[model samples]
Target chain A: MRKIGFSVIYFVLVSVIFILNYTFEHTAMVSYSFWNITRAVLLIFAVIVFPLLNRRIYSIAVTVLKEELRKKTLYVIFIFVALLVSLIHVFGKIAPANQHVFVGEMGLSGITLFGLLFGVFMSSTAMYKEMEKKTVYVLLSYPVSRQEIVMGKFIGNMISILLFSFLLSLIFVVSLLVRFGPINSVIVYSCFALMLEFVVIVAIATTTSTMLSSTSNIVFVIIIFLLGHMTEKITHIASRLEAQRLKEAAEVFVRVLPDFKRFEFKDALSLGTVIEPSVIIASLSYALFYSAVALIIGMLIFRRREVDRL
Target chain B: MDHVIEIKGLRKVYRDFWYRPKVIAIDRLDMEVKKGEIFGFLGPNGSGKTTALKLMLGLIFPTSGKIRILGKVPTDVRIKEQIGYMPEESYLYGFLNADETLDFYGKLNGIPRARRKERIEKVLDIVGLKHARKRRLSDYSKGMSRRISLAQVLLKDPDLVLLDEPTIGLDPVVSREVKDVILGLKSEGKTVVLSSHLLSEVQTVCDKIAILCEGKLIKEGNVDELLTVNGETEIVASGLKQEDISRIKDVISSSGGKFISSGHPKETLEGLFIKSIKEKQESKSN
Candidate 1:
């Protein structure tokens, strides 16, 4: 229903970004284009509209944040990530093309894998637990809107993931600084890129949690994450299809799905190559755009849902 | 009299996720509650008593027809400001203690800090949970959980309170206290709606009663009016011999009034319970 329309618009926009990026690469086109403008607009909305909305969502968010912290989850996952990455410093001892570079690569990869796992796990289970315990009934019995509940959980998980990301980034950044001599753009951009992925993944997990079981949501969001990074390969495979109609359908599929490959900052991160600002802005636009659309969809689905335990 | 709640042809048909009809939770039904009355919603196990309450609170939408609370639709957010709902289960977050739980709800209702503090203390005192205010709800007894949830309903001093099976799992003492609170709510001019399977307990407090059987309203009326045996009267007297009783019956017949058979009225279970506790206390003191 409404989802199909959003998919179509997203597909067209992604296709346009691909065409313009290609043109800008081959010809004398400017850097500022449709994607850049969209990024600006979305950022503006995030900066302006979210705070206004947060007035109502803040209390719920604070409670959610407390719930997250009170659980063994924060301590369990955070310690696991920190300890696992610290052990990477030992792995650098065994294989060294420059121990620092190897440590940085492995540590960044650890952050990426564990960060997504943290986001997916928290968002999926929080929704399910609330429903199973029927606590959502008491929460809804308040004057808050369903939209606020969805957004509150989203913001709450985001703030938590942000805090988690910051600590991990500090460990990664300080280690890199001590060895490599200063804070590199690669480290900064990688953290930001990983965070953008979190925004999209958390939003997707939260949305699916409204309709699907938490187990299914974890698997579903993970598959999307994997497929999202392969947009380039999928698009290439679609382009080489001999059948015309099939190729067009496949192309539509690729465009409609999110492009996580843009935020593939890990590749540049490991290789120490500079990521383009255009790509950064493009991914930022897509993250905010897709997350908003996903949350709007979640609010719609949840509003119609019966919260009664019968 | 102004109605605090109204239902006109309300029907709720629940369906499975695959779009197959599972149960007609509520068939075409209509009911109303006047302001400042304690409404008794009664039924057998599967008579949709809970379903009806959930529908009234906008927790579930009706399949057909409408429900209005205080002159606005059930789903209207503005109407929620004056309505308080407590579901069949406690459904409260176990991670929070009483103060935090009440604070979360109070903040959501946009109550200010000082006022929320004042009301929290007031409600805590009313529910008799003030001593355990710092313990998490997960650790509280079933009776304690029920009381704290009631405190949440009373926090905002809502005009219309919807309590679903408020005495479902409580001990007799706590249950009596809840009925007293319902009566107190009426004295303050607030309409209170409650559903329970314990008809005797509800009978003591309800001003109006509606009985539902299988999603249909079977009967509804004022408590006294519905239960009264019309055209008959019973007389109770002590120290009456057999000849005296026969004489009373003769007098009733001569007066053209029906005489109903009667024995001494038994004490209610709650009354007996209180009596025993008082006696035990007195004996222990002696």
Candidate 2:
């Protein structure tokens, strides 16, 4: 049932993107067509890379999956997302004739919000829980590398977050179809961008958890998320600054933190604006690059960390 | 003469958040655990026994020094395939049932599915937890959880088993059973490194023992050699009358030897506890 559901959603998403790309191309919207093509390419690339995961990484990931399943954390989060999505009608009723757009915005926002909560909460606690419980001793005693543990955890938590996001997005899609009547393909692009943002959040949280306590890690991740979203504005302010040193400091901050605004498509989706394919590819590449760097830093810290601290 | 574990000048100094040296857990420790022997690591609380165990298992790094397990670096992943470790506490995933816990560790060791299935059952039976294998570890008593911990350590049939206070909270009966399992592993030519504060238990099972105090080895030798009294002797005999006792005393006096006090031998509390349980079982069978 899950596979079929996922397949149908996937097929519908692809078909919609392609159909929109053809329509936009005929109307001379080259940028929109290119964006769709990039989306299709990224989808294909993800499908290809997922199945070739390492065996050790797969085992750790499976353990994390089992832990989450047994703890029912995923179930609770799914129920919350579902309940929030279902409650969107209350907001829809208060809106004007374009109530469908309001509903879509609320539904997507709920998915992103709940998905971030789950992602940040789970990732920040992943390593700390293992240490506090002393389970890392047993795990490290096995024939697995510390890098594998960090990577596996990042992969596992990512999977859980993605699964929940997928479910919530499905509900949102259904809600859109029922109320909005053949939802725009831009919504699909927004969801993809939201997922990419989650990938960055998970990586940062996972990396921070290796060195900090869970609470501190969560705080740090949230601060980074906030700072990341303000990168462009911060950089603009730096460019306008009269003090050279302050301008340079702000510019450095901009360079250091991720530009989360790059992954924001909600405004475009709502305004029915076209996104360029090059922009989509560049945003995805940036996310993947940042995630890899974060994961690498996390693995290094994890490898050097002493389990005796807990 | 083969050493399964070797450590030399090992030091572990823990640091605070500011990177200031806070505690010196192990200080220039040197030790070697030979193959196929049950080596006991005896120390008081906070005496660095657990720290040393963690260092040996590569769960923690040393500040300065070297450690090798199974002739490989402690952190070498390949060495873990033949090593089993049970922490001072159970440290198990509370969400996983006993069966799942064992299965999880088995997978980490990269054991094949067929062998893991067979060995999981075997280890569970060895630890007398076969009946409760379906129960979540969180629901288990302290003793039961320790047994499951032991079961996971033995799941891979590891050649070198490092058990840190394996019988800490167990009942006398269960402690005896755990010691027996340790001995059983020795009988299979597997090297067992056991750390505990229970001196009697260590004396009973360990062929050689090392006592650490304040992160330093105060003593290390054969159990009997370290425990033996140079000038004293104990003699036990049955059905001896008072006259026989006097004659023995006379002989010792004539030889300029002092006779120590003598009394009927008494079983230890642990021994008596185990014996009574065995007798109860025997009577029920009869």
Task: Give the best candidate by DockQ.
Answer: 1
Candidate 2, residues A126-174, lDDT tens digits: the string is 8888888888889888887777788788878877777778777777777
TM-score of every candidate relative to the true structure: 0.89, 0.90
**Looking at every candidate separately, what fraction of the true A–B Cα contacts under 8 Å does it contain?**
0.71, 0.88
Tens digit of lDDT per residue, candidate 2, span B14-90?
99989999988899999998999999999999898988999999888889999989998898888888998988788
Error of 2 at A292 (Å): 1.2
* lDDT for predicted candidate 2 compared with the true structure: 0.82
Worst 10 residues of 2 chain A by lDDT: A1-10
Where model 1 places Cα greater than 4 Å from the true spot, the runs are A1-53, A276-281, B236-250, B253-262, B278-286
Residue pairs in collision within model 2 = A35-A277
lDDT of 2 at B109: 84
lDDT of each: 0.80, 0.82
For each predicted model, how many residue pairs clash, with residues at least 3 apart or on different chains?
0, 1
User: Model 1: per-residue lDDT, tens digit, B32-63?
Assistant: 99999999899999999988888887778999
Per-residue lDDT, model 2, residue A4, is 37
